[model samples]
Target: MVIAWEDGHRSSYSGESLRWACPCAECRGEAGSPGRLARVQSLEADELRVQNVALVGQYALQIAFESGHSTGLYTFGLLRSMCDCPECRARKSAT
Candidate 1:
């Protein structure tokens, strides 16, 4: 997916990377416990298939995958940080 930031910077990400970075409780966990994704040995193709996307108020997006996982609330800030475009990469490395 591609995001056109208000600053006119465009950021892009692939479905595979997004699925790998899922921040849901099941994927990221809580109380210092390891998440399910962390314990998984491999990812199925369906798990990385983006089925739908929904806006959450004005700050985040909730994405659903074909594998039936949809609890990740990807905030704008997090999404920005995840951008791997050359500009974003350079900016991050310079910091």
Candidate 2:
């Protein structure tokens, strides 16, 4: 999906990348536990497919995948940071 920011910047993301970056407690973990994505070696196609996306009260996005994992609330900041555009990549590398 592609998001156009209010500042006229555009960020794009693929389904697989978004799925891999899911920030739910189950996917990102809490406390000292490892997340499911970290333990899993690979993801199936269905797991990476974006089935639906919905806004969460102007703060985040609730994305559902075909694999039935839909717990991640991708906030605007999180999504923006996840952008892989050349500029963003360069900025991250510099930091």
Candidate 3:
């Protein structure tokens, strides 16, 4: 699945990563737990390359990064809301 940040940057992630990165408390945790990415720093452009993408049934996306980060499940809605591209900015501005 495609994971977009809040800075007009887009990256492809696997279904595994997608599910792992789920913001829902059920998947990650409540609010202070490690969740999927506990000590994971924001991904850099060089590391945004999608190594693999796996679909977990029809619920989540698992994304493996070239940097060996394969624990961030990205949901479809989350992916859409995470779109931080210029297009999104323009759309927001227009709105």
Candidate 4:
């Protein structure tokens, strides 16, 4: 998905990456718990792309992946933090 931030910056994310980064309790585990990084796990080729997308009450995105797993809601803050552009990546690394 592609997002235009309030700061006039744009970011894009892959279906698989977003799925892996799912913030749902079932995917990421209970809040404050540790064991959430599933985006780097092994996944089928079809799960690497997005099929459809929906907005969630102006706060998040409900993406339907080709894999049929569409329960996660990605918030704007999380999406912004997931940016993989060169500048974002550099900023992340420096932090």
Candidate 5:
């Protein structure tokens, strides 16, 4: 899926990266465990491809990555809510 930033810049991420970055408890954690990538030593390039994208009802996009992981379903609203640009700005301001 294509993520459009507030700054008018858009980044196209594969389903794998999106899945790896899932906020779900199955892949990550409900109590906010950092993420699966946090445990990986290094990622191979072939692991970063979008295998499939299924629309979960009318709420979320269920993405499968090339690494054979398919669990987190990202909602459109949730994606917008979890935007890193604003969070990054806030972090910079605080620091």
Candidate 6:
């Protein structure tokens, strides 16, 4: 997915990366439980690709991956926080 920030910056992310980064309760699991990445050990790389995307009240996104995972509600802030752009990466490293 791609996002154009209000500050005139553009950000893009690969579907596979986003799938692995799902922030849903199921994906994250209980405080110390195994996560989605751990549970999905047999998945092929193609299974992580996005199949569809839907907006959630203008605040978030609901993405369906090729493997049929689609419960995560990716908030805009969370999406921005996950940006892998050089600027975002540099800012995080600086902190």
Best candidate according to lDDT:
2
After TM-score superposition, the amount by which residue 43's alpha carbon in candidate 1 deviates from its true location, in angstroms, is: 0.5
For lDDT, candidate 2 versus 3, the one ahead is 2
Badly placed stretches (over 4 Å) of model 3 are 1-46, 85-87, 91-95
| Tens digit per residue, CA lDDT, model 4, 1-95 | 78999999999887767878877786776766654454345777777678888999989988887878778888888899899999999998999
Report every candidate's CA lDDT: 0.92, 0.94, 0.59, 0.81, 0.66, 0.85
- Model 5: how large is the Cα RMSD against the reference? 4.8
TM-score of each: 0.95, 0.94, 0.46, 0.78, 0.57, 0.84
Angstrom error at residue 64, model 2? 0.3
Model 4 stretches astray by more than 4 angstroms: 31-41
Query: By lDDT, is 2 or 6 better?
Result: 2
- Ranking of models by TM-score: 1, 2, 6, 4, 5, 3
Query: Per-residue alpha-carbon lDDT of model 5 for 1-95, expressed as tens digits?
Result: 67765667554555444655776666565566656666776566655677787889978878777777677788877666545566545875798
Clashing pairs in 4: 20-39
Candidates sorted on lDDT, descending = 2, 1, 6, 4, 5, 3
Clash tally for model 2: 0
Better of 3 and 4 by TM-score: 4
Pitting candidate 1 against candidate 3, the one with the higher TM-score is: 1
TM-score of 2: 0.94
TM-score of 5: 0.57
List, residue by residue over 1-95, the lDDT tens digit for candidate 6.
78897889888989877887788878888789977667875567666788999999989999988888899898889889999889899999999
lDDT of 1: 0.92
For every candidate, C-alpha RMSD to the true structure in Å: 0.8, 1.0, 7.3, 2.9, 4.8, 1.9
